[model samples]
Target: MKLKTTYLGKVYSFSNLKELFAKANEEKSGDRLAGIAAETVQERIAAKEVLSTLTLEDIRNNPIIPPEEDEVSRMIENSINERIYSSIKNWSIAELREYILSDNTKSEDLKRISRGLTSEMIAAVAKIMSNIDLVYAANKIEVITTCNITIGQKGTLSSRLQPNHPTDDVEGILMSIKEGLSYGVGDAVIGINPVDDSVENVKRLLHATHDFIREWKIPTQNCVLAHVTTQMKAIRQGAPADLIFQSIAGTEKANRSFGITAELLFEANELVRKEGTGTGPHRLYFETGQGSELSAEAHYNVDQMTLEARNYGFARCYDPFIVNTVVGFIGPEYLYNNKQIIRAGLEDHFMGKMHLLPMGVDICYTNHAKADQNDIEDLSVLLTAAGVNFVIAAPMGDDCMLNYQTLSYHDVATLRQTLQKQTAPEFNRWLLEMDIITEDGILTNKAGDLTIFNR
Candidate 1:
């Protein structure tokens, strides 16, 4: 079977990469050839080319193309990793911050620290970063957090409001965007979830997204919210990196269960920074829900809220540009029902904003859950007053991939017009530039956009 592979993130045929690997000697396996061989091996796994039941014996008899996880490469990687850990293991969080902030330190040094540090270590440093130090070190490492906000715009928090299309149809996406955008929603990037795991599918979705962005000049960035590792692999396979995306959780082990790692997260952050892909500070965007801790079996008997707060700290380490707490997502087991779900959303928002992060609330509930549009609407209005960052604009209040009901486009307009709230600053400027909204913040275009839905 043919497969997609990448060399320096440019996609190529797997057969070609394997041929190159066969010609190369063991001495040339690791940290050479522009990191092509390593990434290609990774891509095949992400593409599901490797059989789950395959073992070393199976590999020996029927070799997988471009051998994976070879000992030579692991040894070299491990040795370097050992050195990075040895240097920082004894350092305190203050010292770690100092090390990051020191003028003598190079960005390459910080990148290495980012790669080698464990999630727990990141959490430790995340908790202690003085607010001033947080901003300073973020600037130093180029880990920006403001994706779409105008800081002094009359206390307006930003939102993402994903109108996720089940089929990944460009038209369906545009249909959803037509409603959400005209409503002054989704100022915070319009990230989508792909129906399939194929990297090609992600590229197709992103390509359509770009066309839509150009057609309307949406004044927003974008990301495909596939698995973190999958998204990273896609980025390596030459997908757009507008915003490196993932779903995060509160506990470290729970995060690992989602296949998220500090290493993968740090790598994606650096890739976007180097790629110069967006108009904002933060590069990564994450969607987290209340019950991931118990879902991963990593809770260790902690309450969902506390573990969820710990998640904010975990997200802070990588300096995500945005994190949306999808409260009430997992159903009765974690959040119990609407009452607990609403409270969870509030608590998560308060904790995230207290950390000075760009936090969004999805204000959603699932089909099997005990909430509905009113529940989401109630939570949405309350969070709006609480100054939470953003909310989803999924069509019909259900994200096809996430299988949960969320805020609709009409819901967003209802909140904004009723409360006289506005979207994040930069987007508001674009709306004014486009005349979609009146100078006084009226959505004069909404009635017009609704005509498309009726058609």
Candidate 2:
């Protein structure tokens, strides 16, 4: 396929699909650090112009990392429905983008087309889309999945109660959970990032959250964000886990750095399916982010956005109950500032949803990034408007364990009220029964009072 274009009388050329993908991306520190970003604005535009013309078959034929070289690439390739692929293989990326945004293309139509796409094709389309283009297109698709409760239904915005403590103290964790539940958070899941990832500590946290959900008869899932192997061991020992948790990456090599393989994930999926406590189907939780591959030195010169899409491709194989991108957590070396972080958050959420994965976003930032609570707040609103499945809520937007700032319990409550969104159906019912919210989903006077749980 042609890879040359002229912008303002200057010809720009990209040597390969990998280079075209990188140069076509919006500015990202990760791509710049990898020494593959476009050298000028004109060059960037030229790259997008060329990328928009390449057919889906061209992208599929020129794999970023060939299937023979990587299991992730292989899995993504193998997952495509040959019949669906053949129907649309001739469409250019621009045609694909317009089709997704067209008034006639309904959500189910996008779902049918997605079965034919590879991660590379998804990334290619996203690169040519503007920020609002990404938003508007993604809003059309709603991916619903179930663990203990259903999420991603229209008019719903869920929150994961991240009751992370610095020391993994059971009481401290429980106290946070109670506080979050009081504010009507945790509809998505009560997930914790443990300071200690040992099997015993993981199991302890799992049992703590599980018991609390049981005692209150809360309609939600519980999980501990530890290594998959550690979580697997805990589950084997009879830890009460409703969903299994792991952080996944785009490349097999980066996944190896996280101590996971496709085979291992398959085994985890089977284990949770047979031994876990969640309801029918869909029981895995995966966290992915841009720059993970480069952090592990396994990016192979691909842009972070494309690699992020590959993360979804691999994740879809197991039909995860929930998958979120911890958007701004990796620091400024990758995302640089609020603008980059915001762009990446929207891109990731849209890509994940386009893959038909029930996607959430950890709208977060580190101390060093040129972002703050306001930036996170801005992104949270944007993603919510885009019909995001869920967002992570820490105690007042600060995580003592992970040492990052994200959306807070108060923020989630405010978002639902301001945007007229409700929690998952079952979780909304629980909130009404607890007197935390009214039948209209507004917070009642009893809301935000932790002592309500004590009574």
Q: Which candidate number maximizes lDDT?
A: 2
The prediction achieving the highest TM-score against the true structure is 2
lDDT of each: 0.59, 0.93
Q: Model 2: per-residue lDDT, tens digit, 1-455?
A: 99998789988988999999999999999999999998888899999999999999999999999999999999999999999999999999999999999999999999999999999999999999998988898889999998888889999999999999998889999989999999999988999988888999998898888888999999999999899999999999999888999999999999999999999999999999999999848899999999999999999989999999999999999999999999999999999999999999999999999999999999999999998888889998899899999999999889998898999999999999999999999999988888999988888888667787774
As a whole number from 0 to 100, the lDDT of residue 214 in candidate 2 is 92
Clashing pairs in 2: none
At residue 401, give the lDDT of candidate 2.
89
Output the lDDT of residue 218, model 2: 98
lDDT (10s digit) by residue, model 1, range 44-157: 333222222222122222322112422211221233355666665556445665676688875457766654543333323433343334334433332224653432133564
- RMSD to native for every prediction? 17.4, 0.8
Prediction 1 TM-score vs. true:
0.65
Candidate 1 ranges with C-alpha deviation above 4 Å: 1-145, 148-154, 445-455
Compute the lDDT of residue 241 as modeled in candidate 1. Answer: 59
User: In model 2, where do residues sit more than 4 Å from their true spots?
Assistant: none
Please estimate how well model 1 matches the true structure, expressed as its whole-model Cα lDDT.
Answer: 0.59
